[model samples]
Target: MIDFQPISPLQRTWLLELGLERAFLARLPQAQPGGQSAPVAAPAQEAAAAMQTAQPVERHLNDAGSPSPSAPAAATDAMSARDQALAVLRKSGARPVAAAPVEEVVQRPAVLIQPEKAQDMASLLEQVQACQECGLHTGRAQVVFGSELLSEPDWMIIGEAPGTSDDRSAKPFDGKAGLLLQAMLNSAIPNASVYKTHLVKCRPLGNRPPTQEELAACRAFLDAQIRLVQPRRLLAVGHLAAVALSGRDEDLETLRGQALTYTDAQGRSLPLVVTYHPASLLLRPQHKANAWRDLSLLRELQNQP
Candidate 1:
């Protein structure tokens, strides 16, 4: 018969120094005080147990904590390569070896267009047409500026970028998706008017994902639109739009129906809401329930006195 022993104070202290808790040290035979048998855990079993125990901490430490459903394979490959390099160095008996710093590479500089400060919409349109700060500018067929009434609007909707139809039309939110977005707004605000725009001006090649650079380069234009509209409420659609506006990569699931605040050009705090993109909803109809909830929250906010 085997009996388990309690952990030693010295070993518990060592494990604690390594960022592990005394409870975890107590599970390991090496840390256990002498005189009793301990149940040996297989390496895989030990790893599984550790993972289960540390899951919450791991989530907090991760940048987004949740996997992006739309993350590209190339990005995953890059991450794997980095992990492999670190592993090889560690296994090579390299003394004092440290993991490389994960530098967030920005593909391009962001632009800030404060349309409220602009002389007129025509001039803002001209500026958007000529802007070329990212590689997407070269690949685009046309630029999608934005659409809004000449008069002031109560609501403003922002999306990630131009799709095939939008790229060809140079209009933000055209086609079935546009129709759906309009319907959603009309349902919520009955008599209220809503403005629409994209984060990036140009359409990415082959409808490929917009890189960080492309989003950054066009940030100014979106910012400018917000300043000009000064809408009572702003709705950021899509993961990219949410991240661009919030300055954080939070999952749409967690962000939906939640109210956030963004600083406008005048540094005024603007109320913000996040929702699934019309395009995404078209792809995954199941998310429409959540979208409806978000839209309902937006309606409630707008109706608030």
Candidate 2:
């Protein structure tokens, strides 16, 4: 039988820093038959449900037109990505993740998306499901193109590649991280749908970050998404995607707390914001205050010219 004990916040941090947390998660079974290994879609209904559960806090503009109370004053920081995911699993009384075999290499036939013909959303969805540009498609149970688009929301949100829950549910913001993301968006961009997507469509076998080749293979789809959404603003959730979308090598910390602009290949310039991934927030709740600042900035920019 597995034993989990209560630990202080400091102890939890120490464990994570020592890689004990990762080691624990690693030792877990490679598959979770009844656990959250399934991909989840970011549901449109989530926005409504989140809004109902957690009514967004009101923010009034000051004379200078800045949002008041930028972030939560205090938040307990005992959770990390693994802990959050595991918490959800434990809560559901779900089975543990499957034990994965060491040194498993996946091979897949190379295939590509027809960028030009993917002119509309419907065509793109059709093509994305069948795409095998990289090895990702071989592992994912389904493709989560985007949960669902609601008429080109004001902001186009992009995140890193899929995790187990995302892969299992084929939902952009599925899982515990997704739960937090929905709360963030509902509380912040109450009137708007996040229209969140990923750098890569398919999961990277074991929740691993997508490689440059994989991201490159999927760039056309993102560009097409940009064209289709034509959003006034852009929000990148994590460091990899923030750097990838911006085509920069700067560290994520340096990129935070600002609203920059990114011009697409078609010369459309959109206001952009960067913040910690919700998964990061689940792992490090302390950053939620900072993420609030980022989302606040996104909110402020979207209201601007």
- Global lDDT of each candidate: 0.68, 0.69
What are the runs in model 2 whose C-alpha is more than 4 Å off? 1-112
> Per-residue alpha-carbon lDDT of model 1 for 42-64, expressed as tens digits?
23333333333333222223376
lDDT of 2 at 69: 55
- C-alpha lDDT (0 to 100) for residue 196 of candidate 2: 80
| Model 1 bad stretches (over 4 Å) | 1-117
Query: On a 0 to 1 TM-score scale, where does candidate 1 land against the true structure?
Result: 0.60
lDDT of 1 at 127: 68
Worst 10 residues of 1 by lDDT: 52-61
lDDT score at residue 233, model 1, on the 0-100 scale: 75
Q: lDDT score, residue 53, model 1?
A: 34
